[model samples]
Target: MNTEEKGLGSWTEREREELLELGHALFACPELGFQEVKSARILEDFFEKNGISFEKGLSVTGIKASIGKKGGYHIALVADMDALEVRDGENAYPFHSCGHSIQTAVMACVLKRLKERGIAEKTGGQVSFIAAPAEEFIDFETRAKLKEEGKIRYFSGKQDMISKGVFDDVDCVISMHINGDSGGPLFDINSTLAGFMVKKVIFRGKASHSGAAPHLGRNALHGASLAMDGIAYLKDQLPPEAGLKLHPVLTSCGGTVNVIPEQAVLETYIRANTLEYLLEAGEKFDRCVTHCGEALGIETEIINTTGYMPFAQSQEITEVVHRQMLELCREDQIVKNVVSGASGDIGDLGYLIPAVQFGFSGAEGRIHSAVFSVGDEENAYFRTARVAEKTVEAILSDPSLQVKNPDFQKKKEFYLREWLGENRE
Candidate 1:
């Protein structure tokens, strides 16, 4: 894995080996959201070995390390530190199917290079490396419990971090994700991500004997079916450019065949390309569910939880990244202006600060699947890190590349008031 063979002369052989090893270590011991103890330790040990100091215990397992002066133009290099749950046969285990391990490794490499070369000091600015947890947005039961214990207020790591004042002083953010090889480009820039909200509806009805007195009982499952039908019909009215998505699953319907079920539970996420459409679609969805339940003589209870916001990448920062990508690869190997239906917590961060999460290809299988694996170490780890390092340098050195700074308090107040509602507080 020499620099001459891969054209990654910026990194020494020892540094390259260390970065790859770090990625492998994180990949080997995968952990779920908000429970990433081992993953956090791996990153902490790496920072310590590199003589970089960091603060831990954020959102339970998140770590924040910074360099250079404070109260200046600050930029963040964000990495998500969690894995997806993959089921094999009857068993399920945590796996790095989304290439988050690669993200953490690349950000760590960038931070190390910046510190070793004193780039931040020379530019008279600050750069923060944030190893954020719980980007997967799973394990709701655990998160609910954590909320009850006052350990966390938001389910997503970045959301909780924002609430805890982690991004208060940050001016902009730079993040990356690993994409499966499409036989097209090695890098993707200026991609748009969907915002989403979680909905849990419970339909309540009367129970009765199925064979003897079926007519006397109200059918909750029937009510849920009608609501689903209404949603399906409403889908036609939604705008295509909104990129809305609704996938509902019945978590509980009935117990036995002979008994009329007294309750039915349906949960899903409402996703859209922007916050305006997201809220509008959510109101329509709630009306559909409630009206369907009313028509069926069943009582419906809806609980809404705030999910990640939609991501509109900062063109300012994205242009810098694009230039960096071109320096490493041909124009054909770089993709721009991609719109994806995927959702991530980085969207929440982007609401307050200008953020860009570019995608890189070096994996062999579909992300979030059991078969996903690292196919090329050079493209995945070395080249990705080089681009990030160069982008940070460019942004820090050029003061004119600054992003608009929104009032943190006002933005957060609106986010909590409109999206999270009064119940979260």
Candidate 2:
């Protein structure tokens, strides 16, 4: 057996089998954000089996669990519990096609070996594995309703957790995404992700019968069309470094074709790498909407969301992890720095503490597609777990690994102050 399968001879067959079963079980049960009944229960059961202790439901189905007596280094590991929302012939919601099932299972497996190695006892630090909800950011209407009912202040689980002070005491945090199985080039360094602005563009005018009174009505739909055209023009002006994207989807308009639609709602995701640049692009967007509304005599309300801070990995922590990766390197691989066009909550966490997203791909196929399957389940569950274990071991065993990354701290402090708009209270 490989070192990963054996867990350095620490993990047992029974434990590995249990972990594998948990993976498939999660795949079978798909839950949406803030409504993860089955997912939460399965995770809780895993903790119970492993003798890990945790507090339940900080903010709707989010479980905060910890192992080891060491609170000194107190690092947190995160795994999103919610599944993707693409219809898989279900009577209700979508499926776990994104493979969060693998992500959670792999983390659980790592936790097992960490226990066997006495990592918690030796490192004098604890790893809090959190099954955070709402990472997928699904169902805007339901999220809006929850916001109104005061059940959640924000749509995202991580943001809500941050608001509740879940991360106030944590030092560093990490999470793994199952990017299908592939060979090298799985992980990236200082991976910059897309920052998004969720906005609702409502164009309002007047409605009248289209047959005889076509000129009597001022059409909101026409104004929306103009706004989309303006947004499309941004591609040329956008900075290449911005990681920019403008996707405007028309959500609601007048129902009938005979009447001019008085009110139209367009959902737009305005994204970029740097906030300054994104803010600039946002100004351009606002101007375009403003022009469209004014020209069409339509009133538009632009509501921009509390967009997530960018995911900028700590170079210091990344450097340490890379060095450790080199020591653990196989002949087929080398640690690398890669750029990502995707935006995630991981960047939001970096605003509070240093963060890094190390990726692993065993095999490749269409991810998030209807026909998607794990590229190499055998290697992913076991080998990836070992990679996590080895990294955690280095962090605990090497005092140098515990050495602070000054650059990471500096950037982290900067963003935290910027995001919080003041000192953290």
Highest lDDT, which number?
Answer: 1
lDDT of each: 0.89, 0.73
Given candidate 2, what's the lDDT at residue 223?
93
Model 1 TM-score relative to the real fold: 0.93
Q: After aligning candidate 2 to the native by TM-score, how far in Å is the CA of 265 from where it should be? A: 2.9
- Candidate 1 yields a Cα-based lDDT of 0.89
**What TM-score would every model get versus the actual structure?**
0.93, 0.84
- Which residue runs does candidate 2 get wrong by more than 4 Å? 1-10, 69-71, 89-93, 183-190, 208-217, 255-261, 324-335, 363-365, 403-425
The 10-residue segment of model 2 with minimum total lDDT is: 2-11
Question: Candidate 1: deviation at residue 145, Å?
Answer: 2.9
Tens-digit lDDT string for candidate 1 (1-425): 55644748578888888898999999998999899999999888988888988999899999999888987789899999999999889989999999999999889889989999999899998999999999998988998999999998888899889888888888999999986574658899889999999999999999999999999999999999999998888778778998989888889997589989899999999999998999899999999999999998999999888888999988899999999888778988888887889899999888888899999988888888899999878888987898899999998898999776667678888877787673455
Count clashing pairs, candidate 2: 6
